[model samples]
Target: MATSKFLFGLLLLLILVEMNIIEQPWMPGVEAIDCSGKCNYRCSKSGRPKMCIRACNTCCKRCQCVPSGTSGNKDECTCYANMKTHNGRPKCP
Candidate 1:
């Protein structure tokens, strides 16, 4: 009986930890930004991909772009490109 109770408690703890990890926001993955058309032009002309990445990192916490293949993970996070226009042009490559 005691062993069963300990196991149950351990399981509960593990579950709580898992929940926390799932709930926490995740940072953007490498190769996350897609420099297609306008995005590439803006980044190249302005030289500000790092700034865009930073902005996206901050905004992604609240907004959801796309879900990840991994369970309970987000594949795409919200970024500036999605939010604002890029110099009246389309995305770049």
Candidate 2:
């Protein structure tokens, strides 16, 4: 009886370990995409570098990436590029 209990405990432990080794379940757009060092746009020329940085950071946080420059690299992330204003203008700065 003691041997049987020990074997059962070992089997349970192995099952738990196996579960941990499995891949995380599918989660869409749940993880933060890092966009470090990618906000180097011409925001300074816009006379509102601070505002540009804030807008860039906001978009980067959502898309996990940034475009190449200030004007038109929206191809990097469709979600970021497609983000629009109430009047249908691009919202990212």
Candidate 3:
């Protein structure tokens, strides 16, 4: 009975580990995307550089893409384009 319980516990632990592995968004061996560089380019023309970089980074991470050019190309990334501030203003640069 004790041996059976031990085996069952081991099986449960393995199943949980496998589930965690499957649920992860990032996969091993895939190159990490450069969110900082893209966000920098996206926010370059803004008067508020810090604020723009901060917002752009958040949007880039969530959208996994940044619109091309320094400004007014939000249409390139639907997720980035759709994010809004508390007062309904656009979020990304």
Q: For each candidate, what TM-score against the reference?
A: 0.26, 0.53, 0.66
Candidate 1: tens digits of C-alpha lDDT, residues 1-93: 999999999888778756664342344342233333323333443456766445434433334332232222322433423544357541211
Q: Which ten residues in a row have the lowest lDDT in candidate 3?
A: 22-31
The true-versus-predicted C-alpha distance at residue 3 of model 3, in Å, is 17
Off by over 4 Å in 2: 1-36, 40-44
Task: Give one digit per residue, the lDDT tens place, for model 3 in 71-93.
Answer: 88777889989999999999878
Q: Every model's Cα RMSD, please?
A: 12.1, 9.1, 6.1
* Tens digits of per-residue lDDT for model 2, 8-79: 998887787567653335444355445545664535456777777777777777766677676676887787
lDDT of each: 0.42, 0.69, 0.83
Off by over 4 Å in 3: 1-32
TM-score ranking from best to worst?
3, 2, 1
Q: How accurate is candidate 3 locally (lDDT)?
A: 0.83
The best candidate in terms of TM-score: 3
